[model samples]
Every structure is written in structure tokens, then in C-alpha cells.
Target: ELKVEQNPLFLSMQEGKNYTIYCNYSTTSDRLYWYRQDPGKSLESLFVLLSNGAVKQEGRLMASLDTKARLSTLHITAAVHDLSATYFCAAEPSFNNDMRFGAGTRLTVKP
Candidate 1:
């Protein structure tokens, strides 16, 4: 079974601040994906980290994975109010081909 964990279930930040959300998995995973969700909106993919030490970035968000550690991180730089949303990290475990997602990190960027 693949289990995923995330920390800082909630975050409140001021504009221009920086923060990082973490994702840890219990088993070996060959792929990881980061997604963002806004109120009443569907999920939007932000990054697709495919291999060990793989990293992807778009806008103020960056995501990376370390396959050996079964861990991934989403770094937010210079946060803006428009960045407020929920972020989720998902992983597909090689053992079972099942995908699991971490509990979302809800972020609120205030002015």
C-alpha cells in the first residue's frame, strides 16, 4: 500500500513571504505530481516530478522529489494573494500501481 503524508495542514502568509510544504511517502514511487486547487475550482497540475532529484517550477511554485527518501517538497517563493489555494502531492507506488495523495496544505496569502 502507498501512504502519503503532508505537514502544516494550514498556512497563513503575508504577500511576498516564502514557505515550503512537504510530502512523504511510505513506498517507492516512480512518479510524483503537484496540484493546486482554488475555491470551487478543479485541480490544476503544477508540477510533474518523474525521477529522483527531478524538479519542476512554474510561477512562484517549485516542486522536487527525492526517490531514495520517498519525499517531495513544494516551495513557494514570494507568495502573492493570488496564490492562496490548496496544494496536493500525489505519488504512484511501483509495488501496486496505486496512486495516493497527501492531505492538502491549505494556504492563504493575505495582504
Candidate 2:
């Protein structure tokens, strides 16, 4: 089984600031994915890290993974009120691809 951990479950940031959310897994996997969700909404895929050092960026959000360490990260740059939402990371566990998800980080960006 795979265990996933995420830090800073809640974040409040001012517009124009920067922050990062981290994800750690207890087991090995080749695939990691990041997602975003707004209140009363469904998950929206933001990134897909398929290998070591894989990274993806869209607008103010960036995501990366280190397969050797079973770690992934989501970086937010130049915060904006519109960016307020919850973020999650999921991993394909132990090569079984069973899939496990992090607890999620809720970010509130203020102007």
C-alpha cells in the first residue's frame, strides 16, 4: 500500500506572493499527478510528472517530481485572488498503479 502526505493543509497568501505545497509518498512510483479544485467543483488536473525530474507549468502554477525520493511539489508564483482553491497530488503506488492521493492543501489568496 502507498501512503501520501501533504504539508500546509491550509494557506492564506497575499496577491503577488509565492508559496509551495509539498507531497511525499511512502513507496515507489513512476507517475505523479497534481490537481486543483475550487469550492463546489471537481478536480482539475494541473500537472503530470511521469519520471524523475519531470515538471509542468501552467500560468502561475508549477509542479515537479523526484521519483528517487518519492516526492512531488507544487509551486505557486505571484499569487492572485482567483487562484484560491485546493490542490492535491496523487501517485501510482508501488508499481501496482493502485493510486493514492495526498490530503490536499487549501490556498486562499487575498488581494
Candidate 3:
């Protein structure tokens, strides 16, 4: 089975609003990561967490990982048009080199 899953494949958020996305995995993993992508652009690495209780944030986004629970969270403090993009969470399995990505949360920040 795939290791990673994310909810709300599409998120329509208003400016100055706050929201959170959830990522759940099926098994233990070596690493978890969050990435953002703009239209027609490559992914922009957001966070890489290797252990449980690891949390990191930049700008309006915050990410956390809990290895024991096999879950991750991405919180958006205040949405903006500039923050409109696709967010993905990935996991590297403990026994394999492959990384599995979530379907992705597409955030649309409206004015």
C-alpha cells in the first residue's frame, strides 16, 4: 500500500484566512517532507523532518511530523494570493528508497 495520504485535494481559501491540511501514512517511514509547487514550476522544498515531533515553519506555512502516528500536518496561518499553490507531503518508507507523495492539496487564495 501507499505510505502517504492527504485530505482536501482542493482548498479554496480566502485572503487572511487560516486552515490546516492533514497527511496520513500507512506505515513507519524514514522521513517526511512538505513541498510547494507553483503553476508549471518545480517543487519548492518546504520542510524535511527525519524524526518524530519535528516541526518547522516558514512564512505563512508550518509543518509537523509524528513518526509514531505516521501523520503530518501543514497549517496555513493567513492565506494570500501569493500563497496559492499546490502543497504535497511525501514519505520515504523505512525499507525502501522510494518516496510516496500525496495527491496534493491545491490551495486557491482568493481576494
Which lDDT tens digits does candidate 3 get at residues 1-111? 556889989999899999999999998898998999999999999999898999999999999988888899999998889999999999988889789999999999999
Whichever of 1 and 2 has more lDDT, that candidate is 1
Candidate scoring better on lDDT of 1 and 3: 3
Considering summed lDDT, which 10 consecutive residues are worst modelled in model 3?
1-10
Q: Residue by residue across 1-111, what tens digits does model 2's lDDT show? A: 888999989999999999999999988886898989999999998888888988899999999899888889899999999999999999886458588889999999999
Query: How do the residues 8-42 of candidate 1 rate in per-residue lDDT, one tens digit apiece?
Result: 88999999999999999998888898889998999
Q: Could you tell me how far off, in angstroms, the CA of residue 46 lies in candidate 2 after the best superposition?
A: 0.8
Error of model 1, residue 51, in angstroms? 0.7
C-alpha lDDT of residue 96 in model 3? 90
RMSD of 2: 0.9
lDDT of each: 0.91, 0.90, 0.92
Candidate 1 weakest lDDT stretch, 10 residues: 92-101
| Candidate of highest lDDT | 3
